[model samples]
Target: MTGGRLRPGTIFGIGLNYADTIREMGRETPTTPYLFPKLTSSVIGDGEAIVIDTEITSRVDWESELAVVIGETARDVPAAEALGIVRGYTVAQDVSARDLQEADGQWVRGKGLDTFCPLGPEVVPAADVPDPQQLAVRTWLNGERVQEGTTKDMVFTVAELIAYLSSFFTLRPGDVILTGTPSGCGDFRTPRMALKPGDVLVSEVEGIGRLTNPVVAKT
Candidate 1:
Protein backbone atom coordinates (compact mmCIF):
# COMPACT_ATOMS: atom_id res chain seq x y z
CA MET A 1 0.00 0.00 0.00
CA THR A 2 2.65 2.52 -0.92
CA GLY A 3 0.21 4.73 -2.80
CA GLY A 4 -1.72 6.04 0.17
CA ARG A 5 -3.97 3.01 0.45
CA LEU A 6 -4.46 0.55 3.29
CA ARG A 7 -2.58 -2.72 3.38
CA PRO A 8 -3.81 -5.82 1.58
CA GLY A 9 -4.40 -9.45 2.59
CA THR A 10 -2.12 -12.37 1.66
CA ILE A 11 0.62 -11.77 -0.94
CA PHE A 12 1.29 -14.66 -3.28
CA GLY A 13 4.38 -15.15 -5.47
CA ILE A 14 4.73 -17.07 -8.70
CA GLY A 15 8.28 -18.39 -9.05
CA LEU A 16 10.09 -19.37 -12.25
CA ASN A 17 7.36 -17.89 -14.40
CA TYR A 18 9.82 -16.69 -17.02
CA ALA A 19 11.09 -19.21 -19.50
CA ASP A 20 14.39 -17.52 -20.32
CA THR A 21 15.10 -17.08 -16.63
CA ILE A 22 14.44 -20.75 -16.01
CA ARG A 23 16.75 -21.73 -18.86
CA GLU A 24 19.41 -19.32 -17.70
CA MET A 25 19.33 -20.97 -14.29
CA GLY A 26 19.60 -24.35 -16.00
CA ARG A 27 16.16 -25.47 -14.88
CA GLU A 28 13.43 -26.99 -16.96
CA THR A 29 10.27 -25.04 -17.72
CA PRO A 30 7.61 -25.72 -15.13
CA THR A 31 4.38 -27.29 -16.34
CA THR A 32 2.50 -25.12 -13.87
CA PRO A 33 3.22 -21.97 -11.90
CA TYR A 34 5.39 -22.32 -8.78
CA LEU A 35 3.88 -20.50 -5.83
CA PHE A 36 5.28 -19.09 -2.58
CA PRO A 37 4.11 -16.80 0.22
CA LYS A 38 5.74 -13.59 1.43
CA LEU A 39 4.99 -12.67 5.00
CA THR A 40 3.58 -9.17 5.34
CA SER A 41 6.46 -8.33 7.68
CA SER A 42 8.83 -8.88 4.80
CA VAL A 43 7.34 -6.10 2.69
CA ILE A 44 9.00 -2.69 2.62
CA GLY A 45 8.40 0.40 0.50
CA ASP A 46 10.71 1.83 -2.15
CA GLY A 47 13.86 3.75 -1.11
CA GLU A 48 14.00 1.61 2.06
CA ALA A 49 17.16 -0.22 3.04
CA ILE A 50 17.34 -3.94 2.28
CA VAL A 51 19.24 -5.33 5.26
CA ILE A 52 21.55 -8.19 4.44
CA ASP A 53 22.71 -10.73 7.00
CA THR A 54 26.42 -10.64 6.27
CA GLU A 55 27.22 -13.11 9.01
CA ILE A 56 25.08 -15.92 7.64
CA THR A 57 25.26 -15.17 3.95
CA SER A 58 27.65 -13.46 1.58
CA ARG A 59 25.59 -13.81 -1.56
CA VAL A 60 22.41 -11.84 -2.12
CA ASP A 61 20.67 -11.34 -5.46
CA TRP A 62 18.01 -9.05 -6.83
CA GLU A 63 14.89 -10.18 -8.65
CA SER A 64 12.49 -7.68 -10.21
CA GLU A 65 8.88 -8.85 -10.43
CA LEU A 66 5.54 -7.38 -11.44
CA ALA A 67 2.99 -7.53 -8.62
CA VAL A 68 -0.73 -7.87 -9.16
CA VAL A 69 -3.12 -6.53 -6.50
CA ILE A 70 -6.49 -8.20 -6.22
CA GLY A 71 -9.65 -6.12 -5.95
CA GLU A 72 -12.12 -8.94 -5.37
CA THR A 73 -12.27 -12.51 -4.08
CA ALA A 74 -11.86 -15.13 -6.78
CA ARG A 75 -12.13 -18.90 -6.77
CA ASP A 76 -11.98 -21.07 -9.88
CA VAL A 77 -12.18 -17.96 -12.00
CA PRO A 78 -11.74 -18.18 -15.73
CA ALA A 79 -8.76 -16.63 -17.51
CA ALA A 80 -11.08 -14.40 -19.49
CA GLU A 81 -12.33 -12.68 -16.35
CA ALA A 82 -9.13 -12.73 -14.32
CA LEU A 83 -8.07 -9.18 -15.15
CA GLY A 84 -11.42 -7.89 -14.00
CA ILE A 85 -10.52 -8.73 -10.40
CA VAL A 86 -7.21 -6.84 -10.42
CA ARG A 87 -6.97 -3.54 -8.60
CA GLY A 88 -3.52 -2.34 -9.63
CA TYR A 89 0.10 -3.21 -10.37
CA THR A 90 3.35 -2.49 -8.60
CA VAL A 91 7.04 -3.34 -8.78
CA ALA A 92 8.69 -5.72 -6.30
CA GLN A 93 12.28 -6.67 -5.80
CA ASP A 94 12.50 -10.22 -4.56
CA VAL A 95 15.79 -9.95 -2.69
CA SER A 96 17.13 -13.42 -2.08
CA ALA A 97 19.79 -15.06 0.08
CA ARG A 98 21.06 -17.64 -2.38
CA ASP A 99 22.77 -19.89 0.14
CA LEU A 100 19.73 -20.19 2.34
CA GLN A 101 17.49 -20.67 -0.68
CA GLU A 102 19.56 -23.57 -2.00
CA ALA A 103 20.20 -25.18 1.36
CA ASP A 104 16.61 -25.18 2.51
CA GLY A 105 15.34 -27.00 -0.60
CA GLN A 106 12.47 -24.48 -0.55
CA TRP A 107 12.10 -20.73 -1.05
CA VAL A 108 10.34 -19.89 2.23
CA ARG A 109 13.36 -19.33 4.48
CA GLY A 110 15.43 -17.66 1.80
CA LYS A 111 12.67 -15.38 0.56
CA GLY A 112 10.86 -14.72 3.83
CA LEU A 113 13.65 -12.77 5.55
CA ASP A 114 12.96 -9.28 6.83
CA THR A 115 13.17 -6.58 4.14
CA PHE A 116 13.62 -9.25 1.49
CA CYS A 117 10.60 -8.01 -0.41
CA PRO A 118 10.73 -4.35 -1.49
CA LEU A 119 7.52 -3.20 -3.13
CA GLY A 120 6.39 -0.04 -4.87
CA PRO A 121 6.98 3.55 -5.55
CA GLU A 122 3.24 3.55 -6.11
CA VAL A 123 0.50 1.27 -7.31
CA VAL A 124 -0.85 2.00 -10.80
CA PRO A 125 -4.56 1.39 -11.17
CA ALA A 126 -5.44 -1.54 -13.41
CA ALA A 127 -7.62 0.69 -15.56
CA ASP A 128 -4.50 2.59 -16.52
CA VAL A 129 -2.67 -0.44 -17.85
CA PRO A 130 -4.56 -1.81 -20.82
CA ASP A 131 -2.33 -4.83 -21.25
CA PRO A 132 -0.31 -6.14 -18.35
CA GLN A 133 1.04 -8.84 -20.62
CA GLN A 134 2.85 -6.50 -22.97
CA LEU A 135 4.66 -4.15 -20.62
CA ALA A 136 8.44 -3.91 -20.41
CA VAL A 137 10.37 -4.64 -17.19
CA ARG A 138 13.95 -3.91 -16.29
CA THR A 139 16.32 -3.97 -13.31
CA TRP A 140 19.37 -1.84 -12.67
CA LEU A 141 22.12 -2.26 -10.09
CA ASN A 142 24.13 0.85 -9.28
CA GLY A 143 22.75 2.45 -12.46
CA GLU A 144 23.80 -0.44 -14.66
CA ARG A 145 20.91 -2.21 -16.37
CA VAL A 146 21.14 -5.90 -15.56
CA GLN A 147 17.75 -7.36 -16.43
CA GLU A 148 15.54 -6.36 -19.38
CA GLY A 149 12.51 -8.10 -20.79
CA THR A 150 8.83 -7.89 -21.58
CA THR A 151 5.84 -9.56 -19.97
CA LYS A 152 5.12 -11.08 -23.36
CA ASP A 153 7.95 -13.49 -22.56
CA MET A 154 6.14 -14.75 -19.50
CA VAL A 155 5.44 -18.46 -19.66
CA PHE A 156 2.02 -17.81 -18.19
CA THR A 157 0.12 -14.55 -18.67
CA VAL A 158 -1.22 -12.67 -15.65
CA ALA A 159 -4.79 -13.59 -16.48
CA GLU A 160 -3.86 -17.22 -16.97
CA LEU A 161 -1.95 -17.22 -13.71
CA ILE A 162 -4.94 -15.87 -11.85
CA ALA A 163 -7.19 -18.48 -13.33
CA TYR A 164 -4.70 -21.25 -12.56
CA LEU A 165 -4.20 -20.08 -8.98
CA SER A 166 -7.88 -19.51 -8.21
CA SER A 167 -8.59 -23.07 -9.18
CA PHE A 168 -6.84 -24.17 -6.00
CA PHE A 169 -7.30 -21.43 -3.39
CA THR A 170 -9.57 -18.43 -2.91
CA LEU A 171 -7.94 -15.08 -3.77
CA ARG A 172 -9.17 -12.18 -1.68
CA PRO A 173 -9.01 -8.42 -1.86
CA GLY A 174 -5.54 -6.91 -1.39
CA ASP A 175 -3.90 -10.26 -2.03
CA VAL A 176 -0.92 -9.79 -4.34
CA ILE A 177 0.58 -12.06 -6.91
CA LEU A 178 4.22 -11.32 -7.76
CA THR A 179 4.87 -12.36 -11.34
CA GLY A 180 8.37 -13.82 -11.77
CA THR A 181 11.47 -12.00 -12.91
CA PRO A 182 13.26 -12.40 -16.21
CA SER A 183 16.74 -13.69 -17.04
CA GLY A 184 19.99 -11.99 -15.94
CA CYS A 185 19.74 -12.66 -12.23
CA GLY A 186 23.12 -12.54 -10.50
CA ASP A 187 23.01 -16.19 -9.44
CA PHE A 188 22.64 -17.32 -13.04
CA ARG A 189 25.76 -15.56 -14.27
CA THR A 190 29.02 -17.30 -15.07
CA PRO A 191 30.96 -15.85 -12.08
CA ARG A 192 27.81 -15.17 -10.06
CA MET A 193 26.97 -11.61 -9.08
CA ALA A 194 25.92 -10.85 -5.51
CA LEU A 195 24.75 -7.67 -3.86
CA LYS A 196 27.28 -5.65 -1.88
CA PRO A 197 26.74 -3.29 1.02
CA GLY A 198 26.74 -0.18 -1.16
CA ASP A 199 24.83 -1.52 -4.10
CA VAL A 200 21.62 0.14 -5.26
CA LEU A 201 18.90 -1.88 -6.96
CA VAL A 202 16.25 -0.25 -9.11
CA SER A 203 13.31 -1.94 -10.77
CA GLU A 204 10.97 -0.40 -13.31
CA VAL A 205 7.86 -1.52 -15.10
CA GLU A 206 6.73 0.38 -18.16
CA GLY A 207 3.90 2.77 -17.23
CA ILE A 208 4.40 1.79 -13.59
CA GLY A 209 6.92 3.92 -11.69
CA ARG A 210 10.40 2.90 -10.63
CA LEU A 211 11.51 1.55 -7.22
CA THR A 212 15.01 2.17 -5.91
CA ASN A 213 16.66 0.93 -2.71
CA PRO A 214 20.06 0.67 -1.10
CA VAL A 215 21.60 -2.55 0.18
CA VAL A 216 23.03 -2.56 3.71
CA ALA A 217 24.65 -5.13 5.95
CA LYS A 218 22.64 -6.34 8.93
CA THR A 219 23.83 -5.09 12.29
Candidate 2:
Protein backbone atom coordinates (compact mmCIF):
# COMPACT_ATOMS: atom_id res chain seq x y z
CA MET A 1 0.00 0.00 0.00
CA THR A 2 1.11 3.59 -0.62
CA GLY A 3 2.14 5.67 2.37
CA GLY A 4 -0.76 8.04 1.86
CA ARG A 5 -3.11 5.26 2.83
CA LEU A 6 -0.81 3.31 5.09
CA ARG A 7 -1.09 4.48 8.68
CA PRO A 8 1.30 2.57 10.91
CA GLY A 9 0.71 1.98 14.62
CA THR A 10 4.13 2.85 16.01
CA ILE A 11 7.19 4.02 14.11
CA PHE A 12 10.53 2.84 15.44
CA GLY A 13 13.90 4.00 14.07
CA ILE A 14 17.40 2.58 14.43
CA GLY A 15 20.66 4.50 14.32
CA LEU A 16 24.39 3.73 13.82
CA ASN A 17 23.56 0.28 12.55
CA TYR A 18 25.60 0.51 9.39
CA ALA A 19 29.37 0.14 9.43
CA ASP A 20 29.99 2.89 6.90
CA THR A 21 27.58 5.12 8.76
CA ILE A 22 29.51 4.63 11.97
CA ARG A 23 32.76 5.52 10.26
CA GLU A 24 31.25 8.52 8.53
CA MET A 25 29.92 9.85 11.79
CA GLY A 26 33.18 8.93 13.56
CA ARG A 27 31.36 6.82 16.14
CA GLU A 28 31.75 3.33 17.50
CA THR A 29 29.41 0.48 16.77
CA PRO A 30 26.77 -0.07 19.39
CA THR A 31 26.49 -3.43 21.14
CA THR A 32 22.72 -3.16 20.75
CA PRO A 33 20.35 -1.24 18.53
CA TYR A 34 20.47 2.56 18.97
CA LEU A 35 16.77 3.14 19.01
CA PHE A 36 14.56 6.21 18.54
CA PRO A 37 10.93 6.95 17.81
CA LYS A 38 9.39 8.83 14.88
CA LEU A 39 5.94 10.26 15.14
CA THR A 40 3.24 8.70 12.95
CA SER A 41 2.17 12.22 12.02
CA SER A 42 5.35 12.60 9.97
CA VAL A 43 4.22 9.90 7.56
CA ILE A 44 3.76 11.08 4.00
CA GLY A 45 3.38 9.37 0.65
CA ASP A 46 5.31 9.52 -2.59
CA GLY A 47 5.03 12.87 -4.43
CA GLU A 48 4.32 14.65 -1.17
CA ALA A 49 6.44 17.66 -0.34
CA ILE A 50 8.90 17.46 2.61
CA VAL A 51 8.35 20.97 3.89
CA ILE A 52 11.31 22.53 5.61
CA ASP A 53 10.71 25.34 8.03
CA THR A 54 13.88 27.31 7.39
CA GLU A 55 13.33 29.29 10.56
CA ILE A 56 13.44 26.14 12.65
CA THR A 57 16.47 24.46 11.07
CA SER A 58 18.31 24.67 7.80
CA ARG A 59 20.25 21.42 7.90
CA VAL A 60 17.54 19.10 6.66
CA ASP A 61 19.09 15.76 5.68
CA TRP A 62 17.97 12.63 3.92
CA GLU A 63 18.34 9.05 5.15
CA SER A 64 17.48 6.14 2.91
CA GLU A 65 16.37 3.01 4.74
CA LEU A 66 14.73 -0.38 4.53
CA ALA A 67 11.47 -0.35 6.46
CA VAL A 68 10.20 -3.55 8.05
CA VAL A 69 6.47 -4.11 8.49
CA ILE A 70 5.28 -6.16 11.41
CA GLY A 71 2.78 -8.91 10.64
CA GLU A 72 1.75 -10.14 14.07
CA THR A 73 1.85 -9.36 17.78
CA ALA A 74 5.18 -10.59 19.08
CA ARG A 75 7.02 -10.20 22.37
CA ASP A 76 10.39 -11.47 23.46
CA VAL A 77 10.86 -13.41 20.24
CA PRO A 78 14.01 -15.21 19.22
CA ALA A 79 16.06 -14.02 16.27
CA ALA A 80 15.46 -17.28 14.44
CA GLU A 81 11.71 -16.74 14.64
CA ALA A 82 11.72 -12.99 14.12
CA LEU A 83 11.23 -13.06 10.37
CA GLY A 84 7.95 -14.89 10.77
CA ILE A 85 6.41 -11.81 12.32
CA VAL A 86 7.28 -9.59 9.36
CA ARG A 87 4.50 -8.85 6.95
CA GLY A 88 6.64 -7.14 4.33
CA TYR A 89 9.10 -4.37 3.45
CA THR A 90 8.96 -0.85 2.07
CA VAL A 91 11.13 2.20 1.22
CA ALA A 92 11.34 4.99 3.81
CA GLN A 93 13.18 8.28 4.20
CA ASP A 94 14.21 9.21 7.75
CA VAL A 95 14.37 12.94 7.16
CA SER A 96 16.19 14.82 9.89
CA ALA A 97 16.73 18.35 11.10
CA ARG A 98 20.42 18.13 11.98
CA ASP A 99 20.50 21.38 13.94
CA LEU A 100 17.76 20.37 16.34
CA GLN A 101 19.03 16.80 16.51
CA GLU A 102 22.38 17.96 17.85
CA ALA A 103 21.33 20.96 19.88
CA ASP A 104 18.72 19.07 21.89
CA GLY A 105 21.12 16.22 22.63
CA GLN A 106 18.26 13.90 21.62
CA TRP A 107 16.65 12.88 18.35
CA VAL A 108 12.88 13.03 18.79
CA ARG A 109 12.45 16.68 17.83
CA GLY A 110 15.04 16.69 15.09
CA LYS A 111 13.89 13.53 13.37
CA GLY A 112 10.20 13.62 14.20
CA LEU A 113 9.22 16.82 12.43
CA ASP A 114 6.06 16.83 10.33
CA THR A 115 6.50 15.05 6.95
CA PHE A 116 9.95 13.87 8.00
CA CYS A 117 9.13 10.23 7.34
CA PRO A 118 8.16 9.30 3.79
CA LEU A 119 7.21 5.74 2.76
CA GLY A 120 6.16 3.69 -0.18
CA PRO A 121 4.98 3.26 -3.50
CA GLU A 122 4.00 -0.24 -2.29
CA VAL A 123 4.87 -2.95 0.17
CA VAL A 124 6.58 -6.11 -1.02
CA PRO A 125 5.37 -9.14 0.85
CA ALA A 126 7.78 -11.00 3.14
CA ALA A 127 7.38 -14.03 0.87
CA ASP A 128 8.46 -11.91 -2.10
CA VAL A 129 11.58 -10.57 -0.46
CA PRO A 130 13.47 -13.74 0.40
CA ASP A 131 16.34 -11.94 2.11
CA PRO A 132 16.16 -8.47 3.58
CA GLN A 133 19.90 -8.29 4.13
CA GLN A 134 20.70 -8.67 0.46
CA LEU A 135 18.92 -5.60 -0.82
CA ALA A 136 20.49 -2.36 -2.06
CA VAL A 137 19.41 0.94 -0.50
CA ARG A 138 19.97 4.32 -2.08
CA THR A 139 19.10 8.01 -1.92
CA TRP A 140 19.16 10.75 -4.54
CA LEU A 141 19.18 14.47 -3.96
CA ASN A 142 18.09 16.60 -6.89
CA GLY A 143 19.07 13.88 -9.38
CA GLU A 144 22.47 13.37 -7.75
CA ARG A 145 23.21 10.11 -5.98
CA VAL A 146 24.31 11.05 -2.49
CA GLN A 147 24.05 7.78 -0.58
CA GLU A 148 24.65 4.21 -1.71
CA GLY A 149 24.95 1.07 0.37
CA THR A 150 23.56 -2.42 0.86
CA THR A 151 21.50 -3.84 3.66
CA LYS A 152 24.21 -6.45 4.13
CA ASP A 153 26.38 -3.74 5.67
CA MET A 154 23.92 -3.28 8.49
CA VAL A 155 25.46 -4.09 11.91
CA PHE A 156 22.12 -5.30 13.22
CA THR A 157 20.25 -7.59 10.89
CA VAL A 158 16.47 -7.40 10.45
CA ALA A 159 15.87 -10.50 12.51
CA GLU A 160 18.11 -9.31 15.30
CA LEU A 161 16.45 -5.91 15.43
CA ILE A 162 13.00 -7.46 15.52
CA ALA A 163 13.91 -9.84 18.27
CA TYR A 164 15.62 -7.11 20.23
CA LEU A 165 12.68 -4.78 19.94
CA SER A 166 10.11 -7.43 20.73
CA SER A 167 11.90 -8.27 23.93
CA PHE A 168 11.04 -4.85 25.36
CA PHE A 169 7.61 -4.31 23.83
CA THR A 170 4.99 -6.03 21.76
CA LEU A 171 5.23 -5.56 17.99
CA ARG A 172 1.77 -5.33 16.51
CA PRO A 173 0.69 -5.68 12.92
CA GLY A 174 1.23 -2.50 10.83
CA ASP A 175 3.99 -1.34 13.15
CA VAL A 176 7.13 -0.31 11.20
CA ILE A 177 10.77 -0.62 12.04
CA LEU A 178 13.10 1.68 10.08
CA THR A 179 16.21 -0.43 10.06
CA GLY A 180 19.23 1.96 10.35
CA THR A 181 20.35 3.94 7.33
CA PRO A 182 23.73 3.46 5.69
CA SER A 183 26.51 6.05 5.61
CA GLY A 184 26.37 9.05 3.25
CA CYS A 185 23.90 11.27 4.99
CA GLY A 186 24.41 14.95 4.28
CA ASP A 187 25.52 15.49 7.87
CA PHE A 188 28.70 13.54 7.17
CA ARG A 189 29.41 14.89 3.72
CA THR A 190 32.54 16.95 3.18
CA PRO A 191 30.65 20.09 2.21
CA ARG A 192 27.33 18.98 3.59
CA MET A 193 24.44 19.04 1.15
CA ALA A 194 21.27 20.05 2.94
CA LEU A 195 17.78 19.85 1.52
CA LYS A 196 16.42 23.17 0.26
CA PRO A 197 13.36 24.48 -1.42
CA GLY A 198 12.68 23.08 -4.91
CA ASP A 199 14.89 20.06 -4.38
CA VAL A 200 13.68 16.49 -4.67
CA LEU A 201 14.65 13.47 -2.57
CA VAL A 202 14.27 9.94 -3.79
CA SER A 203 14.60 6.86 -1.54
CA GLU A 204 14.69 3.36 -2.99
CA VAL A 205 15.07 -0.21 -1.85
CA GLU A 206 15.76 -3.18 -4.06
CA GLY A 207 12.69 -5.37 -4.67
CA ILE A 208 10.49 -2.94 -2.76
CA GLY A 209 9.92 0.40 -4.54
CA ARG A 210 10.99 4.02 -4.90
CA LEU A 211 9.55 6.93 -2.90
CA THR A 212 9.92 10.45 -4.31
CA ASN A 213 9.32 13.61 -2.28
CA PRO A 214 9.98 17.22 -3.06
CA VAL A 215 11.57 19.72 -0.69
CA VAL A 216 9.81 23.00 0.02
CA ALA A 217 9.98 25.81 2.53
CA LYS A 218 7.16 26.06 5.05
CA THR A 219 5.28 29.19 4.18
Strongest candidate by lDDT: 2
Model 2 misses residue 108 by how many Å?
A: 0.2
Q: TM-scores for all candidates?
A: 0.96, 0.98
lDDT of 1 by residue, 1-219 (tens): 645332657878888989899889888888999988887788888888999888878778999989999999879999999999999998988888889989989988888889888888888999999999998889999999999988999999999999998999999988989999999899889899999899999999999989999999888
- Angstrom error of the Cα, residue 5, model 1: value is 8.3
Give candidate 2 misplaced runs (Cα > 4 Å). Answer: none
lDDT of each: 0.89, 0.93
Instruction: Pull out the clashing pairs in model 2.
Output: none
Candidate 1: regions farther than 4 A off: 2-6
Residues forming the 10-long window of minimal summed lDDT in candidate 1:
1-10
> Best candidate, TM-score-wise?
2
Residue 174 error, candidate 2, Å: 0.5
State how far residue 184 of model 1 sits from its true place (Å).
Answer: 0.7
